[model samples]
Target: MCKEECPYDFRLAEVVSKLKEIQARKVLVQLPNGLKKYYPILRTTLEDLEIEVFLSLSHSWGVCDLALGEAKKTMCDTILHVGHHGQVALYTLSDIKIVCSPAFYKRNPIPLATRGLKLLMAKGCKRIGLFTTAQHLNYFQELREALSEAGAKVHTTQIFPWMPGQIIGCRFDTIVSNLDRKVDAYLVVGGGIFHGLGLFVTTNKPVIIADPYSNRLIEVAEEASQILKKRLFKLMEALDKKNYAVVISTKIGQFRLALAQKIRDLLRGRGKVAELVVADEISPSLLLNIPWAQAFVIVACPRIAIDHQEEYPYPLLNPGEVKYVLRGSLEEYTPKDSLVPNLSLNNVA
Candidate 1:
């Protein structure tokens, strides 16, 4: 029998209902790389239906990587975006049937951090800001109550229009806008170091992650610090590079063509040689052709510069980091507008 837990037992009935509602015979299914394990199950489940299923085999990190274009290219009538929320970045497409099925992983016995109570007490962190991925949102109330009972003043950023306490990798606007000044530290309530690290970088506050699977308290300071140090080193190294390629994405949400052009113009004014490289997808393997450039400034997803810099041959800094390097000061390093477009800064300096 198929388990009902998350990572399993995706209801085929809903997909059938949606397909029938829209009268869609051809469907395109897009899953984040991690959830691709469900591809076979999903395909098999849909085999008997009156739908033609096509799995999107593209590289997708977040909503920023939705396969809308691929769906259009393949002439799919409906798009099933899995693993994340229904909030695909593009805004203008109401013509096609777009179904967002978020993958869920149920945590029974409630993965509350009772054992980590001692660790939390020891950290000397009293005012805590809580954040998490959407998967663990169901247990937010229990987890918050548990933390509060442990004698810590807990706060979750809820200003986001999406799920409360939810911090997606690219957008930290929810945390930035909703957090009170009294917050001394952050507690991420899901697995993985990515969201926690992003929170730490954006807030410059100490972050701890509560992994549901392990139910252990993981301090993200050391790892986040190490990554930031590498970025700083790269920035310092690239400060002297005269030739830079400002990369822009052609995707609907990730596009920053104007920003890329602006950066290129700024570099030229500063007596540096610069060029703009436009592409739909970015990767270390994809960027290998531009060997003539000494450095590359990314106007794509902010995570590329944060996480994938080491993958590249040369320095790859985001717009804000590039500005910091060029100016050589943290005095005015406000990355209000980063790589991802239509990103709301809302006066978060």
Candidate 2:
């Protein structure tokens, strides 16, 4: 039984059974920040089962940020990754048992969906594109039914490596391109305006965030427009910059050496000083040390440039924004072409 202390279902019983089935004596436990408070529940359960648990204190951004290396170093045969799921690769690749235990929120999303429906209908959004984060996926069916019962045509897609109607921060372009033509507006059933803003910017369509935690309907059209304007200003500043540093992530799943190499070559070809900077985590303070580059182009996750631009003193450009620096024209941006390809276990790092 799930404890009353945590609202999310950690599926402790299922995890214990799996560990027993695999005869896993030593296990590594991983949890995202939001789910860290309930780590004691998981740790206690695992300890009761005589499973040696090693907790990872590293940042758990997504399924991509698995603690496989940590498990290897600690001699743990299995990894219990919590809070997200549906993107697991086979154990053949890692030679270790990787169990993904996704935490599902116990709260119903219908109330927030009903409120968002009214807002979406008021904006004349009859065709709704539905999407949400991994935690809210358990309520996806009921939320879709609520929208359809209200006379809205709902469109959903099972994007590779993502559940039906699921959206990751980095893959907004892939999601928008697949559903933009099919829907009039997007209704994201998640916690914040983060995914909603991504959809609005990518498709240039109206987006409604059905926040279950706050029980509110958030319209992100205006916010996305403001973000676009800021990005345009940054891109304009990038055009006149002489030196460039293209950042490539060293994270297992986010590593994109090929795209970073392409950007470096593109800048050097234009008679600009360019070099590739490798990093495990990209932050403003870390980049501030490199004083030579006037601007930096991120080839890892595109959201870093769009959402966290104010933190950096210099202009931060995504791979799609690099065209403005090269051609000196603000043509239509299609991140599908410039960014790295879709992720798969075989291709990561």
Clashes of each: 0, 0
lDDT value, residue 95 of candidate 2? 76
List residue ranges in candidate 1 displaced over 4 A.
Answer: 1-16, 86-94, 112-118, 180-182, 213-216, 328-349
- Summarize candidate 1's per-residue lDDT along 1-349 as a digit string, tens digits: 2434435334457766665666777878888777787687777666667678999998766666667788888898777777666232222254556776655556631445544444656778788887667666656778778878878788876634666666687767556766847687888877778778777777777777877766667788788778777777777778778889998887766887878887788778777889988888888887898887989988888888878788988988777665554554444433333332342323323
| Worst 10-residue lDDT window, candidate 1 | 340-349
lDDT of 2 by residue, 289-337 (tens): 9999989988777778888998999998887667666775556544332
Candidate 1 similarity to native, TM-score: 0.86
| Highest lDDT scorer | 2
